[model samples]
Target: MISKTTIDQVYETARLEEVIGDFVQLKKSGSNFKGLSPFSDERTPSFMVSPVKQIWKDFSSGKGGNVVAFLMEHEHFTYPEAIRYLAKKYNIEIEETEQSDEQKEQANERESMYLVSEYARKYFSEILWESEPGKAIGLTYFKERGFTDDTIRKFGLGYGLDQWDAFTQTALDKGYQLEFLEKTGLTIVKEQTTGEPRKFDRFKGRVLFPIHSMSGRVLGFGGRILTNDKKAAKYLNSPESEIYHKSKVLYGIYFAKQAIAKEDNCYLVEGYTDVIQMYQRGVENVVASSGTALTPEQIRLINRLTKNITVLFDGDAAGLRASLRGIDLILEQGMNVKVCTFPEGEDPDSFSKNNSYEDLVLYLDENAKDFIQFKTSLLAQEAANDPIKRADTVRDIVNSISKIPDRIKKEIYIQECAKIMEISEEVLYDTLAQIDKKGFAEASKKIKQEQKAFEVVKNDQVVEKVDVQYELERKIIEMLLLYGNLKQEFEDLVLKENEEGELVLEPEKIEAKVYEKVYLDLQEDEIELTNTQFRTIYYKLIEDLNEREEFTVNTFIANLNQEMVSEVSSILMEEERYVLHDWERKEIYPKEKGQGIAQLVGETILTLRCNLIKTRIQKLQKGTEGNNGDNSEVLEEIVNYLQLNKLLNAKLNRVLS
Candidate 1:
């Protein structure tokens, strides 16, 4: 475990906006900084970072939390991992307690796989730099491709020995598990007739490139073969596994995220070398799909960093034609996409090496075309000779345009395409309408199928029901958050013997005491919140109330898990939005409705507690009336309930008047 002192220091020293600003371009908006939503594609800024509160909210996704929560959400770091990231960023030294061997063995499988991959990366990198064969072959190959030693090391380039089972033997000798090595696809396992495991190197005689997740955890590897053997593939990637999904992983993202966010744009390329060359040429905001056809998952990963993508292609006509489909997928996610092509004889790798950084930048800036215009020009020549091809190409482009989630962007693209293709805007709109109708029909069919499955589960009564007590608990929580500090004068009940020889009520001084009343009432009833989020908030409120300090919503939110933060923020903000709006406009006077709602929420909580208390009191009465009953606990609770009833009456009197 990390020392509490170290954790406190890390949290205290780390500025939320400073940490997040490194990965997002935030413009000041009033007291807060706003940027494009990192969790989704949006032209308008909906992601907000509040420096005063030390939290961020992505209004688009309803995700709001403190600095650690942002790292967990955006970079996919676990709780401890996020803390460690903050520690590293703020230059805090972390001292953790040593774990036993059994404790290490108890770590989660995914984390273990991550550790194994990281170890392999270091081992391969060391071999590449330190070994004679690795330096001569692998390091020389990278240098021949115009890669600097810094660039090579930055990408974790490495080499595997040519001898069979060399890596497997080394890994086993180092106490690494053979099973995980095979599972990660670093070492292949063969089963003989005797059912024994035979392990061998999977990327022997190839230079290695370690693939990393956004948080810098090694997920897999890509290897390039050295020899030109007819049977051997030129490039081999780690097979799909639990930790590494090829379609979702983009090469060089771990390095390019900050640059991409800073520039507010990302350059999409085809290969590893393309990414390296572009970065070396001072275009640092570039990443590669690593030769795979782009997947929606990969696009979403980039979407987290920037809303604009510029795809770079070589001047080879066939490759350009083949890659146009990926651009359509990007547009479907409502992202801005531009296309640029290099000279006929050059790719990004060759062009960047041959030209100065300024020339490359200038060339791209001058040649880049919006997706609509680029697609139109590319398809127009083929369509000129054939009317049928022209109509089909028009439909194809319209289909791509229809995939855009934003209607305004769709219309803009439609106008651009119509003007370029010499077609009427009305015609393009009509065609897009047909495509949308077909898509809606298919989507409706899928929804119906899902609903049928959901109905089966519903019929079985598998869904958990929210009880009345839960609602009451939530209402109480809301009131405590909003009106806990609001004070009012009220009549306090005091017992006295009157002339009639009976107990009588005398008025005494009292304050509203919202937090105290709620806490004492909950304690009297022994009612526990069943909802996890409500329970978390309730306990936190109790802690604050016990200290007699006003509850700070931001402070409470900062300490919660990201998932719980979203849940709590949604509950708090959903109700407050309309209330605050009405108050601001001065359209709704604070009269009966507002006061009545507050009173009702408070009363409902008291009623629930009172009923539960009364039931327990009855049980206690029965047990005491019988034999072997200890009523001390019950007596103490009854006395507490009487005091709570007095307090509740005091609060009710102020509301009633």
Candidate 2:
């Protein structure tokens, strides 16, 4: 368990915007920040961060809470993991007790795999630096690649021993479970007919590169073979475990996320070394596909940090053709892409190794071309002196162009392609229209087929009836959170006999604190919140407001359980997202909460009283109908309750039948 002092320090020191901004690109919007929803695939931003409250809310997903909540939701981290992540990011020393063997056995499967992978990373790094074979081969290979000792250690590059079962035996001897080792692909285990199972290292005789999540947790490793083995694959990755998916993981995202966001662009490469070499050369905003095909999940990872991606291609023309399909996927996500090919026979690793930082950056800037232009020029050369191939080339470029979501950008690219292909814009536009029509037809056919196969039910329109008691309870909590400690003059209603010998409410002015008024009013009527969650929060909120000289939403929420924390955040941030639109600038002024908080509080309590009286009247009416004897008494009680409900509603300016 982390010490309470350290947890509190982490919460105080970690800024919500700064922590979330490391993963999502946040742009300033008035008092808060807005960015694309990381939880959902969105073109516009619906994720909001409020620095004043030290909380964030994803309007799309309806997930809102403090900094710790955001981390847990986004990264799938447990509560302790989130705190430790924040502590590390802010450089706060975390005081934690070591877990015993019993406690370790109780950990969940995914967490166990993560622990095993992390342990493997440390063990491999030690071997690379300490063991003779590792020093002779793995360390020497990294050194020859021009990687410094700091870089090697920074990435946690390590070596897997050549002997079978060397790593497996060491891990088992240390009490690390063999089940997790097999799950994380650290040790390969095969069941045997004999009493003992056969086991060996998965990355034996290979140099290891640990892959990390966005928060720097070790997910798995990528290994490269050192010696010649024609039968074996050149490179191997950790198997598809619960924690690591190769297609979704980038090579160096954990290291490059900050630089990518800062530069507002990401450099895309094809291998782990390409990323390391470029980063080691001072070009820090670079990541790789890890020798796999580009995936939408991977593209989204980069999209969170930057919209512009500059794909660094080697001089292999055949490989370039194979990579072009991935560029269309990027365009489909509404990202800007550019292509930069190195000189003949040079890749990102070889080129960066040979050039200085300045020269490398200059070379990239000079050679980077728009994806459309690169695709057009490269294909047009192959279509030379052939009209049929030329027509196919035109359609292919248009197809790529149509994948873009923005209509204006599409039109602009069409005109640009027209000029380059020496064809009129009309021809390209015609081809694009035909392609769109075919796509729409195919989509409609699929929808029709699905509808025919399954029975489709359409829901009737629901008439939304307001929940009077629930809303009143929620409003009471909101007011207490917002203005409970403030002192104000209130119009106190006193029920007294009027000149006509009837009960009437007469207004009397009195000065009192907001919480005091609410508490006294509820006590006088003995009204309690009907909603369970609201009732729990109501008492705690009042207690905190009464005791503390100062109140902050973040601190108040910190004391509540996870469920209450989410409720408080939702109540507080309900109207905050609308601020992103700047309604005042559009000539629509909203009523300020600060101006009439006292009236709002009184009206809320009045509404609650009216609802309770109505409920009493309902119960009296039902009792009178159900009973045959002494019905007159119940009728009189119902009449009195109706009169009180009418009087309260009148004061609230509510029209009732």
Candidate 3:
């Protein structure tokens, strides 16, 4: 356990923007910082960081909390681990209490895998620097590639020994479990016929690159073999596992995310070496596809930072053609795509190794072509002197243009493409329309096929039957979180029976704190929230409000467990997301919720009571049919309930049934 004092100090010292900006590209938005949500695939910026409150919220994913919570959600770190990360970031010393045996035994599976992967990074790094063959082979290979000592250490480049079981034995000896070792692909385990199981190092005799998640946790490793052996593969990557999914993981992303956002662009390359080399040369906003086909997940990762992508291609025609498939995916994401080809004889790795940073950047600026131009030029060369190939290339380019979500961008590309191919504008537009029509028909068919499956899934997995009740209960919690201690004049509205018992609106204002008003109103109705968690939070807030002069959202959140924290955050942030105060800037003035806080709070409680009354009325109706005694009182009770329900509907501004 970390000391409470240490945790407090870390939280106090950690700035929300500083912590999250390390992984996300946060830009100034009025009083807060905004960026594309790291938690979801979004084109518009919705992730918000509030330095004043020391909390961040993803309007897209509806995840929000203090700085520590952000790490816990994004890095998948345990609570203590998030605190430790913050402490390390701010250079604070941490004092931890010893873990109990039961606590150690209860360590989670995902966290255990993280522990093993992190341990392996350190272990491999140690071997690369201190061991004989590692120093001579691994360290030597990195240095020979023109990587400086700082560069090697910064990226955590390491080496696996040639010995069959070097890494596996070391990890096992260190008390790391064999199950995790095998799962992480750090150890290759095979069953022997009669003896103990045989195991070996997976990356033996290879230099290593530790691929990191956005929060800098070790997810997996990429190893490059240095031998000239004809039988061996040149590079091997960690197989898919819990923490590592290569399609979603960009090499050097943890290091380059800030730069990518700052530069307003991300440079996509094919190899880890290319990213590392170029980044070291001061072009910091660079990432590699890691030789895999580029995936939309990878594109979304970059989209969180910026919408501009420049793909760097080597001069080789065959590899370049193979890589072109990825650019359409980038375009489909609505990102600006620019392609840069190095000199015919050189790749980014080789070129950056020799050229000055200034020269390399200048070359890129001068040579980079828009994807449409690059595709047209490259394909036009291939389609030379063949009418069928020319027609096919035109269709292929049109297909890519159709993939673009922005119709204006598609038309712009179409115009540029027609000029390049010497074709009329009408022909290109006709081709695009055909492709879109075909795509829509296929998509509609797929949606129809899956509509039944979609119906079974609940909204946020909460049942629809009582969703409105849940909303009202959750609204009470939101009111407490946002304005619990603030005192304001709450309008008390009533309908008067003037002589004939006809309704007349009468209004008065009563000054009270928000929580006091909510508590008293619920107390008067003798009603409680139906949901267990909401009820717990409701009582906890009431208790805290009574016990203290003021209630702070952060302090209240800190007292809850992880589950309640997420629930409470969702309620608070979802309210903020729906808030229309900021929409006025766009000429969309909306009625502010704060304008009628009293009505809002009062109506929520009234609605809950109204639901209960309706339930009771149904019971009375059923009882009247079954009762063998006088049913006058039961029918009278039902009539009175109906009248009370009418008054509640009137108070709620709903039309009476």
What's the CA RMSD for each of the models? Answer: 6.2, 1.8, 3.9
Model 3, position 330: C-alpha lDDT score:
89
Error of 2 at 498 (Å): 1.6
Quote model 1's TM-score.
0.80
lDDT of 2 by residue, 1-657 (tens): 788889889887989999999889999887889888888888878888989988788888888889888888888888888999899888999998777889656778988888888889999999999999999999999999999999999999999999998898999999899999999989888899989899999999999999999989999999999889998889999999999998889989999999999999999999999999999999999999999999999999999999999999998787788899999999999999999999889999999999999999999999999998999999999999899999999999999998999999999999999999999999999999999899899999999998899765668656799988887888899898888889999999999998899999999998998999999999998987889999999899889888888977777888787778778888887777567667888998877667887798888888788778888888778777757687887788888888888888889888888
Candidate 3 versus the native: TM-score? 0.89
lDDT of model 2, residue 394: 93
Give one digit per residue, the lDDT tens place, for model 3 in 503-538. Answer: 565777899988998888788878878999999999
Q: Order the candidates by lDDT, highest first — what do you get?
A: 2, 3, 1
The lDDT for every candidate, in the order shown, is: 0.79, 0.90, 0.86
Estimate the TM-score for candidate 2. Answer: 0.97
Q: Which stretches of candidate 3 lie over 4 Å from their true place?
A: 24-69, 445-468, 490-510, 577-587, 606-611, 632-657
- The clash numbers for all candidates, in the given order, read 0, 0, 0
Error of 3 at 175 (Å): 1.4
Which ranges in model 1 have alpha carbons more than 4 Å from their true place? 16-78, 445-468, 475-657
User: Model 1, residue 178: displacement in angstroms?
Assistant: 0.6
